[model samples]
Target: MLVGVLSDIHANRIALDAVLDDMPDVDAMVCAGDVVGYNPWPAECVDEMRSHDVPTVMGNHDRAVVTETGFGGNGMADAGVRYALDVLDDDRIEWLAGLPESRYCFDGRVRIVHGHPDDPNRYTYPSLFSARLLGEEDVLIMGHTHVQAHERFDEGIVLNPGSVGQPRDGEPTAAYALVDLEAMTVSERRVEYDIESVIEEIEAVGLPEATGARLRKGR
Candidate 1:
């Protein structure tokens, strides 16, 4: 089966749309999470994900937006997350609250999570920690940290499609991944969008200035 993996869509509809436009057709989708926080349209992003039928895990930022837990960092994420916490409707919050931290044993080989296996709170990357934990599974995908890359680990393969909304790697394009489980191959991909338009929306929505700036640079 081919699975499209996406994550960290911090409510930037433009970026999300760009990634979706570029995404190859696949049998299923697994999102690493953070459907909200640090962007212009949290609700719209959530709706888009729902419409796409993407199966997602709860990200730390997504949790913070719902519970007001203040777990995310105090960087560009602070303002938009705080606003989402204040404005999100109860039903949407409940939807986020019901999301799991991880999904395992799906095909008895592929696994998915918002962060590392042992601790979702810890910021683990494919280049750093994923290589060790991927095991012999067909695929292990995750998002957080907003960086995009794929690593062939000791046991299997680890893929980070990157951040669909808040990329911090100095690139404006949205990031994602395509995985073919039958072939055991993964590819990182990016799609360009109207960065300035999203920035204007952020400003219009009164999100943090830093958040707006990061969208252009992908940082």
Candidate 2:
């Protein structure tokens, strides 16, 4: 089976739309998390994931929304969370609250986590991936650093599909991955979206301009 892997889809509807449009057909889809936060359309992003029934693990930003926590004085992040809380209704918030920190999917062939296996809040970049992190799953998927990278080990595969909305890896495109389970292969992907339109929407919604600016820089 083939699966489309996604992560850090931080609430940018335009970018999300672009990613979906560009993705190839797959048997299933999964998210590393942060389905909400850092953009104007938190409610829409959440709804998109729900509509597709994407099995997602709780991301740090998703946790922030449910727990009413913040990065502590990070105005950009705080604004996104507050906006999500304001726009998302109880049912959606409940769904976010219900997201597991980690999960085994595809019948134990894959493990999904927002960050690290040991700590969901920790950023496990591709460089840090090693056989040591692999337990029994064929693949260990992590998100949170907004970087697109993967490593193949004799034991298994470890990867971050990158950020769909708020990419910080200096690549100004939506990032994702296609994992071929039967083939034991991974394809890193990027999609171009309407950043200017999203920036305009960000301004319209009264979010910090830096939030939009970072999208252009992919910072």
Candidate 3:
């Protein structure tokens, strides 16, 4: 089966829409998490996920908004949580609240999580991936580092589709992945979006200016 993998969609509606429009047909889709955070359209982003019925795990930013535990002292992250809380209604917040830290989809052939399998908040970078990370599942999918990378082992695959919003991978543009489960291969993809419009919206929403600035640099 083919699957479109997504993660770290930090409330940037434009970026998410661009990625969705750019993606090819797949049997299913899964999000590693953070549907809301650090952008202008948390509500719309959440609704997009719900309407699509994409199986998603809870991200650190998602969890912070739900649990009232702010993201330590990161101003951008804290602002995002506050903005999402203020903008998202009960049902949307409830949906975010109900998300799990890790979940299995496609009949357990794939496992999805926001961070490491052992810890959701940990940033598991490409350099850290290994076969030891796999646990019975043919594929282990994770986000949180916002860097697009994948590794194939004799046992299984470990992948992070990358961040749909607020990519920190140094090379701008929204990131995603196409996973061919039967073929045991992954194809990472990137798409351009209207970053200026999102920047305008961020300022209009009164979020931190640096939040919008970083998208231009993708760092």
Model 3: residues with Cα > 4 Å off, grouped in runs: none
TM-score of each: 0.92, 0.98, 0.98
Q: Write the per-residue lDDT of candidate 2 for residues 118-180, one digit (tens) a residue.
A: 999897877788989988999999999999999999999998999999899999899999999
The lDDT-based order of candidates, best leading, equals 3, 2, 1
lDDT of each: 0.80, 0.93, 0.94
Cand. 1 Cα-lDDT: 0.80
lDDT of 3: 0.94
Writing each residue's lDDT as its tens digit, candidate 3 over 1-219 gives 899999999999999999999999999999999998999899999999999999999999999999877776899999999999999999999999899999999888999989899999899999999999999899999999999999999999999998999899996799999999899999999999999999999999999999999999989
Which of the two, 1 or 3, has more TM-score?
3
Give the winner by lDDT: 3
At residue 193, candidate 3 shows an lDDT of 98
Name the candidate, 1 or 2, with the larger TM-score value: 2
